[model samples]
Target: MKTKLWFLLGTLALLLTGCQSKNNSGSAQQLNLMQTSDLLSLDTSQHADLPTWNTLENSMEGLYRADKHNQPQAAMATKVVQPTNQGKTYTFSLRKNAKWSNGEPVVAQDFVTAWRRSVSSKAQSGYNYIFSGIQNADAISKGQKAPRKLGVKALDKHTLQVQLEHPMPYFNKMMVMPAFFPQNRTALKKFKSHYGTQSKYLYYNGPFKVTKWTGDNDSWVLMRNKYYYDKKQIHLNKIKYLVVKDANTAHELFSQNKLDDATITGVTAKELQGSKNLIHEKKAGNYYLRVNVRNNQPLANAKMRQAINLAIDRQALTKNILADGSLPASTYTAKDLSIDPTTKKDFAQETTPQQTYNVKQARTLWDEGRQEANLPKKLTLKVLGDDQTITKNVAEFLQDELQHNLPGVKVQIRNVPDKTASSETRSGQFNLSQTLWLADFADPISFMGILNSDNPQNYGKYHDDQFDQLYQKAILDSSNNQQAYWQTLRQMQARLNESMPVIPLYQMVESHLVNPKLQGVLRHPVGEDDYTRAYLK
Candidate 1:
């Protein structure tokens, strides 16, 4: 079955809300943090990366926001509003006290405007597909219907109502996503194409406001928003982020005590183990290789793809090379997140399984793949990834493993900047793309959506109609019958193991540095930080 668009999340943010860190270091009100890449776009509808989303979650207030437990909590709205129309329709009572950093009142109309603009024909919104669950959103995005027909409506200034085409179980969690964040039409129209192009073009309504981002600046600051409804709960006066592309550089900053937090990996991770300031958790995502089987490439042969998946040593990569809390990922969806409805047992522990690792079987498959592609005995393929230190090391390690395990195969590693790497994969310019997907919401369906045949996020174009049908069946069945839904999900994963379009490598245990003095940074596997409640001890 075709899945939905998958969002690639790189590093999970390290917030100091509930972390049990020792206080050996000095305290500071402002937390100096380091992030790997520069912000791509602040526009929620266009930006897809984790860094941008994290920034948006801080600067913009959605109808709901994520809590310390990664559950949806009220932010703009008064509470987690339940649905009507058999779990398809929802009415939100927005907090009248909420206002933008620019001093404009946040109303239901803002959400209406943003939702409509995101689905409109000319919006060029990359994330519009996320709105498909809402009524008429699919039609509006397809241009089959007008934006006005969208399910969202403003009953009055403070009240908003939404009607979904179907009962979307994850709608509550999705409300916290950036796409669901409200946008002022006045600002959108005033800025036009330059909207969110620069920091000044956008308006902030959450815990912080953007100040020093010139759109292309490598560094920016988030200052406390006085107009925010819950500003009293916000502790930090200023949160500064500098884009340090290299992990070693970030590590150096951490060593020098220049940054309060830094995400360390590779050799640096191995060295920092058992530190009092380190509070690590199993990250909620998987690293996988997306084989572009298009253009008659050797990977187009299922045997070739299977050979590649079989050859990799995931255990060594996670333990030796990564040296982080990351574990070998047998499947794309991380274990422990999704449980079987019938057995109430962990999904991965119970039913889903990974393909075996055997060089001999891999070689045999490789030979068959060459024959299937009607190719010569020898072939060369390029593997693509970002230029991050860990990314390059992983790519190199894979190159060595694939070349060593499978004969007649020469592998080349193509490392580019983080931004360009994603663009190249989406544009179909690479043979193999190193990809990752953190569950957009806390569910198996969130991760499964990436494997859909025609999904925009499926850059590899791995299509299986049977899987797509089963996936849709799961989504539909989930509302009425939970048992049937879990069974269907299990079947879908089984089909994935057979298909082997995307080879899962690991489910990373998130690693990071925290200020010993920084207290109460709540650790979440997904969307893992809430600096609003963070305080310097």
Candidate 2:
């Protein structure tokens, strides 16, 4: 179940498309966008994928925005003032003219209701921990406290105050997410459990409003919100999103100008390289292989897990299979993120070998572990992966590499649809699975916090009491001792390496094809909503 949560975080950016064109002969009307992923559900609390969240972020406004540099900027809130001494209280003043698409006033109580619902025991939001520091959020989520005690209060129609159990430096950044976004209480009360179900029940207070949503159909539409406070800055009138799984066909549509943007596949990258519309972005995420520690099988052993990690040739996979500028990963964190600002070097430099494809080392370790465990004569491990070509290729490569390097070990490939794969991982149904983690915000805590034992995302049941304690200290401490925090983080990494619960694979390079004419387009490291200010030339 923990594996499913981590996997969901990684797969968010797997399918998004953008377009930009310099030829300005036509009028600036509706902006048509194409994306590869199909929205599973519009229920903000239930949907965890990036594509869905991205659309929601643009269509719905939040109290704050995580900027390109990873800093939180005020959005719906006019200002956020925190008490300097204790850092436990935050005062938020809403914009005077803020209102929903239906012209209803955007009140502070909207945020209060949304936060209370998210942390409610019945909500089961994977991102419930985002508010763990809130007054009684953790207790409420665990059913030990009531929603009213969850630290959020609407002082008035336009002002909200929040009390935290401890100081959190990233609280503002976390608020930029949908889990913290306000929901229409009227719609929620009327629709009950089906509040976000079709377009009608889903109200909007952001730059764009979801005008149409047909779940069974593969397409949906978003129109600019006329009542949005910053509506004058938004140029595109409407955005229509289509879900096309076939990468080749998607690229073909892009080439023909039928689609504004598309994610190029390995087969199409070279051909589209010379196109002026091609745009490449660095991904703030990492892909890895998670081994089920609770399986009580061969993979449950640390030695066997290390052996499998050493067997695969990640460099070859990146060059041959991925063909993207993805760097090999030696640690769970991405390369750029793994660097310690104080030392200006990677934290993994202190412990663990620089990643290499060492078949001899892998074979020896596997044989030793097999002998010690008194395992069956033949070893077989099941791998769960998404239906994407890249995932299938990676899984096949791992299966071949592990089997060829280790004499008795056999690998079975189980390629399931993305949703099904997610469900299986959440249900703890796999021996091994491919997963990725995208930072919820710029902070290292965004990635580190997910592994906490009580976190809903920790599906593999990997737990470390010491690591948990250090994480708590890092978040609660007021001193800006980032170096000390890194030191503690190094210790946590050491524990993860020793446990071998997961194998870090590679850090992906995000790329998209955009028309050169689309000005005001902002690309952030976290890639939150930057389309509000985007405009056509």
Candidate 3:
């Protein structure tokens, strides 16, 4: 009996020791996520939307970070040195302690590898034009030269040298994006097409690394990387993201405290008004009606675009449909963005607001446009958009307004999935479509520059040689001529208004209910969320 009792005590001691060891090894880190969309891909170069890019920006740190005041500060790059005489030569020295999640050192060659891959013809990166200024980048992407001859190079293990075709003032802000983010060549080679799908294949050098993603699933998680250079500053151990498309469902999750942040849309904004955590942010993007210029029928006429723009009651739409702080837009660029640095005046003042809904004017313009196109009776038009509440409401409003205002016109609403809607818009399939353009960085050119004829993001294929010249000159011009740049941008806006490829709808008012526990959440006017400084209270 004595021997059996001693043996039992020894077994209990061993079990307790094992339990303690397992408990100690378990992680104490966790970050709650609040998102409505599933991340399609982690490849930043291929992403076009601001929300997706913002997610990538949060998971990966860039070379620089723009402050709330729109000033670029060092992020991955320790210092940026520019030569006075060189038109566009900039040298970057990276931080010494930076290392990927796989324990490999982040060197200048990592950036060079990512850049070369993005600019390669085989990659077909959507953002290849962003590196057009780099020597041979355009030529290489066009298959005129090998990608090895691209201007971006690593002088040593730590120093990166970039030579551009022109001097860009907002170049620093561009560096703080995925196009400039470094990637591990070894990991890329190993994973090939599936590099960024899983945590094992993707090596993160940023604040957080993706732990799990069940491709297009509702639930995904991002965990803080212990090997990150500034891991001590990361407060959240894991970020849990869920794709709850319905606004009511998202609000329900937020109210239950299951989600740390959520966007209140539709009628939910009214009930959640004045909540302690309610926050409204004005976005640089604006919703607009894109008219397919390729269609040679009724839509090709500028008068028809004007008629559609004038027929809609924007005030009622905002009050009834939006019921938020969304402002009626007279131009593509928002009012906040029109503030000229030199003249201290709004640049979009020339495009006056059409406050009153003029049905009579709309009917007259519609008749003239139809007569010019030689169409007899009713005109059949198709409007395409996503099935979201806001988009559906806009489509319904336009259908009602146009049908009522013009006696011989009928509008058909075609609702599709979000991804399908985007693809259709890109292919110019619909006669009219709803779309939005979010500024990638805090520069007037970031918004206006995309209207260039050769720009991939120019969905409408709106072209103007003079507009392109002015936009190109604005970027190359020295920072000293502030007034000249503003004037040039205003001219571009005027020309866009004349072309009428798209009719401006309204500026977006983004609202979010965030948990009081999280602190240091960074929100930029350009609609980017940088969570590097974010931590739980």
- Model 1 CA lDDT for position 209: 85
* Residue lDDT tens for model 2, 1-537: 899988886676343212223222122555556655556666766657766686787788788876656677888898655554477888899998988988888999999998888887767558777788889888887889988899989999998989988777767767777778898887788878777766767788988888667665667778878788876567777677777665577777766766666666555664566767877666667789877877466676677878888888888777666665566777676655546666777555554565456888888888888777778759888999877766787898888888888878889999887778888888888889888887776556677788888888777776778778877876764246777877777677777766677788888675467766566656666645466566656
| Ranking 1 against 2 by lDDT, winner | 1
Task: Candidate 1: list runs displaced more than 4 Å.
Answer: 1-28, 120-125
Each model's lDDT? 0.80, 0.74, 0.73
The residue-by-residue lDDT of candidate 1 on 1-537, one tens digit each, is: 123222212121223322323221212367787667768778876667777877776678798878777889888999998898889999999999999988899999999988888877556435677787788887787789999999999999999999988898888988877878899777888898888877888889988887788988888888878898875566677788888766678778988988888888878888888877776777678889988877566788888888888899888998888886788888767876766769888876665564567888999998988897898887888999987888899999999999899988899999998778988988788888887787677778887876776455678888788899998898788788888988898888888887778888988676788878777666667653666567677
Ranking by lDDT: 1, 2, 3
Backbone Cα, N, C clashes tallied per candidate = 16, 12, 3
TM-score per candidate, chains pooled? 0.92, 0.90, 0.88
Which window of 10 residues has the lowest lDDT sum in candidate 3? 21-30
Query: Which segments of model 3 are wrong by more than 4 Å?
Result: 1-29, 80-83, 120-125, 138-145, 197-201, 295-297, 349-357, 478-480
**CA lDDT, candidate 3, residue 31:** 45
- Give the worst 10-residue stretch by lDDT in candidate 2: 17-26
Ranking of predictions according to TM-score: 1, 2, 3
The digit string of per-residue lDDT tens for model 3 on 1-537 reads: 999999999999999987654343224534466554445666654454544565667777667767657667777789655534454788889898998878888899999988888787666336777777677887887778998999989999998888877666667767876777888878888888887655456788887777677445557677777778876556666677777666778788888988787876657776677889889888777788878766564688777877787888888777677765677777877666546766676655544553336888878888898788787767888899976666787798889888888868889999887668877878878888888766666556767766777666667766668788887777656354777877787777777766667788888887788888767777776747777666555
